[model samples]
Target: MRVRRCRESDVTTQIDAHQHYWDPARDDYGWLTPDLAALYRRFGPADLAPLRERAGVSRTVVVQAAATVDETRYLLALARDEASIAGVVGWVPMLLPDTPALIGELAAQPKFKGVRPMLQDLPDDNWIANPELAPAVDALIAHDLTFDALIFARHVAPLEIFATRFPKLRIVVDHGAKPSVRDGAAGWQPWADGIERLARLPNVHCKVSGLATEASHDWTEATLQPYVAHLLASFGAGRLMWGSDWPVLNLNGDYLQWHAVASELLGALPDAQRDAIFGANAAAFYRL
Candidate 1:
């Protein structure tokens, strides 16, 4: 398949819906070990500024890579000083008794647009569905904040139940539930069906990010087409947003490579629809 190269001029207001900036020295990122040399070091706004500039991404939503409230505060502080960081999806202990208070404090920050619980790392697949977390979830809706579900395929059914339970809470499924793209064609099943179900709910959205890390080491545009197609068909451009997944993306590819692949996958879309996935939808969804 001939892939379309993404030109920087294609979208006037490109926004990277998902990305991360972390300093391992902070000691909170448990997953940032030295063995994974590609991503073990610090990645800050200084590193991303050039890449974003080259990609024509005007603004970005920096997500929480660490699960601590301090890290959330860290990102919020970064957003305050960095004009390109449009929003910050920080972390909070949802099940704690004082979660509502924490949410209130975090939401007070203008750039704290949402919370992500890092559902993929949890042992329980149904963790998000626990009614015990209602207070935290309710606080999110009450404050008009969004939820970014960092989940795996197994968590999809539970996510559906969670979304149904809190219909008013705006949720965006990060990385399309991190599909088993490494398995190639055989990986498409339940993941695709599960995403389709989530899309049926009006409050749920999905990001076109992080697939490179989930795919085979030598992944190409063709390797990702079917999955991207399913997302486009399932959520439509209005609910599907583009994300860089950056530095971690360096594990498999670079920002420009993923951007070009995404452009090719979405090349057939109408200009308006393409623009929505590339920028407009995320800006509206995160209120950037």
Candidate 2:
């Protein structure tokens, strides 16, 4: 594992709620094929610490970039060694009978905070609502683990059902359900409606991250404001948090650029509310 100097917690406490690390040499990142040249190269904690310092983000939740346990283990090791990575959202075989035991084993680590399945990549859109997966959901609730929903707009309907069944479970929606920014206004209503419905559930939270990548290549603050505004209105500051999305943000933008956009978008709110959206809410949700 590569270790780097990290920010002292006393000096900075902004938490980046979502980011990822991947090394093709170590694991096969199927989604990160040659077509994604910008993100195809290796990314690890060493590459991120400087960006974190530049953004004034002292800690982060390193999410799984691949579905394999090896990838999760890799992230756990980073969380173990990298002070900037406060917690980890690792992957687990949710449908398997041994999932509870597996979750227990992972959670035994002090930095293991949650689990996130590659839901968007799965063929079935309604997989989150599958009754057969109840045991795993129960395990998460029993262990006080969080669920990072890496879903798309189409998955919102089933997510509502899943939230209803597990009302007490903590869940933070990753990337604002990844709206159809490419379609512009034509794609707003469905995603907005789904987000609003999900927000009605008291347990769900939303992350203001990854929108620039969804928009056109030349996206601007004005281009992303509507989606950001909708998320703020739907989830409120208390239930919303900000994330840099790090190297993934490199596809469309960079850490400081995304952080600046977030600051500009939330500039209107009171400092307390902005503070919650930027870091406090994430700390509370992931129990960092």
Candidate 3:
């Protein structure tokens, strides 16, 4: 990312804990094929420089966009030196029995704040709610690790059950349970209700990020309002957080667009509430 001169106050000391970074040349984003390249456009660390500079957000938590352990360590290394990247939510095989010991090993690294699994893409008949995996999911709470939930509409119901099973785990729901911006309000109530139910779990939180991308290829704040509003209402400021989801969001919107739309939707809140949603909540919850 390009770093320009900025006054001390312009540099936010708080966290912007959900941006993504990928070095295309280092390794191909196997999941994002050439066809998908058009969606991402010109995106990477460089694209976010001005957003950070303008927003005065110094620290951010980088999370896994692709499900892989290497992506986690890759970001952890960045957090080691880049003061702005204060935390990381990397991916791990949480379903495996050995996952707990592995997470314990990574927990030693201060920047490794959480882990995520892209559960939404799984087959409709998948078994994420199995009792066997409960132990590994529970291990995250024991280690004070934040578990970022990236699932789909149908997955929300099961997620609610999962939250009830682990009321103490710090679970951050990314993309507001990933509603379809293209889908009308009628198609999303089930997901919204499911998320609301999960928000009842004290340890659960919601991240206001990646909405522009989740919308249809063509989207506007109006298309995203219902989801964002519902999430804010359910989780409230205390349990809410904001993220750019950077490079990934390039699939549909840029940093400035994401920030501006969020500003319009969330501008009505008090400064304290804004601070909590934008950064403080994440800092307090993840202990960053």
What are the Cα lDDT values of the candidates?
0.90, 0.86, 0.75
lDDT (Cα) of model 2: 0.86
- lDDT leaderboard ranking: 1, 2, 3
What would the TM-scores of all predictions be? Answer: 0.96, 0.94, 0.88
- Which candidate gets the maximum lDDT versus the true structure? 1
Is candidate 2 or 3 superior in lDDT? 2
The residue ranges of model 2 lying beyond 4 angstroms of the native Cα positions read: 1-12
**TM-score ranking from best to worst?**
1, 2, 3
Q: List model 3 lDDT by residue over 1-288, tens digit each.
A: 222322343223545768887765545355765677754343445556678868667678887766778877877886787767778888888778799999998999988888887776666524567677787887788888878888776776677777778888788888787776676765686777787777788877888987777778778777888788888888887898888787777778777677667767777787777777777788987889
- Give the TM-score comparing model 2 with the true structure, all chains together: 0.94
Model 2 worst lDDT window (10 residues): 1-10
Indicate which candidate wins on TM-score. 1
Q: Could you give candidate 2's per-residue lDDT for residues 1-288 as a string of tens digits? A: 122222233223688999998887875577888788888888888898887777678788889888888889988887787888889999999999999999989989888999989899999998899999899988898888999999888998999999999999999999999998978989897899999999999999999988988888888888899999999999898999888787888888877778777777787787678778878898999999
RMSD of each: 1.7, 4.3, 3.8
lDDT of 2 at 171: 92
* Candidate 3 regions with alpha-carbon error over 4 angstroms: 1-14, 26-28, 38-47, 124-126
List pairs with backbone clashes in candidate 1: none
